[model samples]
Target chain A: MSVMASTPSAPVKPKSNTRLRNTLTFWAFVGPLALGLLVFVYIPIVWGFIISFFEARQTVTPSQFVGLTNYVDMLTDPNFVKALVTFLIFAVFIVPTTFFLSLALALLVNNTTKGTSFFRTVFFLPTACSYVVASMTWRMSIFNGLPFGFANIVLGWLGVAPIQWINKPDPPYFWIVLVTVRLWLQLGFYMILFLAGLQEIDRALYEAALVDGAKRGWQTFRHITFPLLRNTSVSILLLSLIAAFQAFDEFYNVLSTGVGSSSNITLARPPLVYIYQVAMADQNYGRGAAGAFILVAIIIAVTIVQGRLFGLGRAEA
Target chain B: MTVNTQTDTGRRVIDRSERIAIVLNYALLIFLSIIFLIPFYVILRNAFLPSKLITAFDWTWLPMPPSTNGWRDLLANTNANIVDGLRNSLVIAILQTVGQIAICSFAGYGLARIPFKYSNIVFYAILVTLMIPGAVTFVPLFVLVASFGWISTFQGLIIPGLFSGFNTFLFRNFFLNFPKELEEAGLMDGLDHFGVFFRLVLPNSMSVMMSLGVITFIGAWNSFLWPLVIGQRSETWTVQIVLSTFMTAQTVNLPAIFMGAAVSILPLVIVFLFMQRYIVEGVKMSGIKG
Candidate 1:
């Protein structure tokens, strides 16, 4: 070890060989993944972008260049516009609701000295269940519009008439189905995140606040806990925003009359679902690809605005 | 004497309020737990109940005459092909998880540890992909997969999902904090970088691997849209597809759908129950570091 340390520099030939080996090692590790990302992710994205400008119809590779016709069509299409509105409404509703609910759950779990793990596990178990399963359970049993359905049974006991949850979109009771299933599926996952954030708070600070006459519950939380949880809150907000933008599975499963009959449910279609219909069902690949870019653009814009609002990157700097 | 009496009363008041608060906390937690567990209960109850009872106007909290009819029907139904679905889903999920961990760990380790000249460029490129959601790429990806003649094959289901920027990102963060001395020792023993990574780095990374593996498995298992698209053939249908088929079938077999959901969820539930400690730890790590 002493002799090796005393040797100031390796011989030039061996040194170059080592450098070559190091480079080879680096590529050996990173090359497959880079190639994969290029083929699977980057290539498809570029291809999608190119096809979006063409009258691609049934074929992904098209001879005709429509030049923004697909974009214009998607923008003008009422269904696409409504899908954007649906996303906006979903983001507005789910973002804050999930934030508070998860945070509250985290706070409650954090406060408890016993059965913390039990509560955490119980809450998080739903995250394992598939969206299709949750959507089916919620649609068929809980909000099934039948007199025996769980929600209607409660309404019956209250002397109120049974409401058709999904079929009758007039009152938009389906939003309840949509929102509740989403909440059940995702609430615990985010709660676990918030719980992690809550645990990071300095216990000493809470004690200091207590000695300084800050009340135990709300006062202490407001001044100390909430302020410290800014980072977690911002990240959770961003994640939920992206999730809202990508809302497809639940909406498609719940609202659609059935498989192959997805075109029937015209109400509450998110952009992905709408794009899916345009591309896969109708074989209008150009419009579908175009709508996808539009959605991506909106997502990027929202993320930027949210980052600015929350001062996301500035804190790290 | 008056001061002492006043202090005792103050202590008593504080104790009573604290007790009430504790009780309220437990009450709220229990209430939330019930709400959380209701869907699971509903699934279990309805899966065992007869179709007539399930659709009846009178609500039964429990399946009084518990029956195996739904489970039997789900297994016996040929079009549903639940057994095939389960096998396909398991194979796809396992392959995807293993492949993802391998590639992501390699890229992550390289980006984090190797002094490669263009590593930053590659890292940023990978990060940029995270912004491009899967919905944006599935169409052309579908076309590309079709071009490869991989539609309805395991290659279509598992291969595209193997390269997740998010997983790579997490792995990079993890490896960045890995002890350098251990790798230096391995290098001193004349092991190459590959050797060090395989023998030294990966073995010590069981926790992160287990956690990420569990996550990837669950995601792959529960994935709906991709499989729904790629695995259009009944032979390649995953459990999720099978579950969706029950609802989408012309008859809408409620009993069979519930049973399928219960079965579909079972593997993940077992996985979660076993690896929950690592799972929670993973979430905490990601939340704090990500």
Candidate 2:
């Protein structure tokens, strides 16, 4: 492993003749993708940061360089602040619920005697379906603010009046719609992650635990299964956290009016939706770019904190 | 005799618990499956029902005497060009998938096998790009593409998404763990790196390649925000954008929108049903590695 680690940088000893050809081959293979990443990803990121410092909008060039002013203005902007709080509330609600639900499903599916793949497929089928399709199905048909909506229909049978699920504000049932759609879309993917982790644990470990008098399922799971799954669980949590921070599709599709309109944005609006509204709809590219960095900083900070808490890269003892 | 009796009791207890667990598992799975299937059921039921029937307060789990009015209206609706959107989506998804596989796999091979000086540095550089949230680059990327006069064009939609940092990492990891003997044999047979990659590596990489291809296609097909931004023109709209348009319109026609949604999801559902094993493997690969 150590030799392989140093192999790329270490100079080849005997192959002195084809050195030029080898270098050329390397460039031919890597150049296009590296160029693509440089131009599309790296350059844009730098340009975005530079533009954030200036008052730029509706044009490629910044009109003026007002250092950190865009950031300050966005920080004070009530809409941006509201959007952040909304995202936190969303992340707080979503991450743990998704984690636990997926873990439970994975445990259940893993323990099943027969038809494991069938259940796995059934659960994972939603992950294949796009957020757009799921959101549309949810917003228009299932949770539409009509008396005949799916949830309302369920409510009606219980002798309750129909409630406006999508449009409701006071109790904010839209959260339910948003949360459930996201859960439906993502739970199976994470469950598969946990299932993979579950499968990776040594069967011998379980037998040994059983032989050592750990007869109860929970005891084995606690001592053998859960500890062994630490890496998968940590990464799953990290991915979920990042995904939550990046939440845009379902909320935007389900909550907002169409593109170029932010009329219905409230409560459940995520940071991306707000930045998109500001940058695209309002055409305030500077603040939008600044807000993007702000969101990135928060995500990075959270990730670092998570990494520290989990000792993420540390090898198991 | 004592040992035989003890083992018998143990086996019986195990059977009882296992049997109970089986019953519980099926029961739980059945209940959750119904919940999971409900949204799909709604979409399918509404897709074939008349607008009035779909929106009516009466509740039925499945459409009774299913009508084709929704599908008809969906096709007739001016705002949603379902056929054109489907064609455009297919074109974009296919292009993006082919582009990523070709680009990332080559890059991965170079990083893994070529052993160029500074290759490690280059790899680390690519990996670091993953740290930068995609949102940070969103606006400027639009501007960059727009400057190239690519906005609302296939270039705009396809070029920017053609390569991915994560995919490159996946391919690199795959190649690093790939059998070196095959490459050595190909080299011994006078095959250059390119020839070896084409004849030996890629053919052997069907599993990872297919996994990447399926996931990428699904992603490209379902992508909403980018296409919504870049494909603003009605003629260039992807299926997802069209679906979003149907729902977010000022006056949403429920039955028609569901019909559109159902149509968009039909291909994916088929793909999932047939290639579910690959899909699960792809997702598993993604999770385990990370």
Top lDDT model: 1
* Candidate 1 wrongly placed segments (more than 4 Å): A1-10, A259-264, A312-317, B285-290
Question: Second chain of candidate 2: TM-score?
Answer: 0.93
Query: What does candidate 2's lDDT look like per residue over A150-203, in tens digits?
Result: 888888889999888877687889899899999999999999999989998999
Worst 10 residues of 1 chain B by lDDT: B281-290
Error of 1 at A184 (Å): 0.3
- Best candidate, TM-score-wise? 1
Pairs of colliding residues, candidate 2: none
Q: Model 1 misses residue A221 by how many Å? A: 0.7
Error of 1 at B246 (Å): 1.0
RMSD of each: 2.8, 4.9
TM-score of each: 0.96, 0.94
lDDT of 2 at B230: 84
